[model samples]
Target: MTKANLLYPRKERVRKKQASPNFKAAGKSIEQRPESINKRDNSGDFEIDTVIQTRAKNECLLTLTDRKSRYQIIRLIPDKSADSVNQALRTILQEYQINSITADNGTEFSRLSDVFDPEHIYYAHPYSS
Candidate 1:
């Protein structure tokens, strides 16, 4: 004889709202940046991004690339918060000759103004560029 399993009531899963900060104050649009940066002939032009480990807890990687030289700098970060990212960029910028930085409009990159000149930092198109 097979024993019947008891049915239990399940609670609805609560969805967490994703963060999307208004980058207007801290980030600039790539469209408005000077045409010189797009050429990528200058050594100081760079691109920035982040990598997060879904399996790990509170660990992220901050990545920077010099558009002209194709050099890359990768560092482990504590989290994906804007403050953490800003501080990381500030420290890295100290060593690099950063003329401009082009980044995607992610929440973590919203406050890059802390490290870069407002006029030199720009965000790529949300869809594609």
Candidate 2:
């Protein structure tokens, strides 16, 4: 095998640790949503989700879309921390009136009820979406 004096590459393969999803929902369950919201009979009801930047792990986009109107609001957040998400939601609340919000079971949304009414924040089932 060494007849041609070929150099053997000595390199170690490092595996990155995968982060587990925080599947705990922060607020009320989606099943608790009122008929007005469930049927999309109102304009103030909205759905919230976060889009993480692929290249910048620390940066994310918070999106809110009105269920009835399909209008959307997108904001750039510095991180996925609950505090950052609350801050972004607070700012949005000042400009818009959101009657209710539906979010996934992400840890970053654990504090959503602090910014909005606890009774109005609904969470989807874990791992369903």
Candidate 3:
């Protein structure tokens, strides 16, 4: 069966209302991100995300993309602990000289604040609970 047919048996309907947060805390939202980083014409800024496998497996993939050149770097890891993720990020940043990064709010990324200075990195809030 096709992906759409297998994933959704029927047309889905949106049921939840959009909830807004009380305030914009540091690294919480990207709404007011620096224009220099979003322009994609200047290099150094990056977007990061992780991909995980099935069955409670610790295996994961870390992906980073340069905002300007669209260049990407992928790292495979055996586990998702904060220390491991931080080590991986440090290695990558050391090699690439990343000045700033934006990432999703995942446990693996919580320690990002420790890896990079808060003034240099940002994290998006979790999509949903």
Which candidate tops TM-score? 2
lDDT tens readout by residue for model 1, 51-119: 998988998999998988899989889999899998888888788778888898788988777667777
What is the lDDT of every predicted structure here? 0.80, 0.88, 0.77
Q: Write the number of the candidate with greater TM-score, choosing between 1 and 2.
A: 2
Give all TM-scores, in the order shown. 0.75, 0.79, 0.74
Clashing residue pairs, backbone N/CA/C < 3 A, model 3: none
Candidate 2, residue 74: the lDDT equals 100
Q: After superposition, which runs of candidate 1 have C-alpha atoms over 4 Å from their true positions?
A: 1-26
Ranking of candidates on lDDT, top first? 2, 1, 3
lDDT of 3 at 56: 56
lDDT of 1: 0.80
Kindly list the per-residue Cα lDDT of model 2 for residues 1-129, writing each as its tens digit. 643565875566887554358544567899999999999998999999999999996999999999999999999999989999999999999999899999987888888888888989999887667
Q: For residues 8-100, could you state the per-residue lDDT of candidate 3 as single tens digits?
A: 576669887543676343465665568888777678899888878787568888889898888999998778777888889889877887878
What is the lDDT for 105 in model 1?
76
Model 3 lowest lDDT segment of ten = 17-26
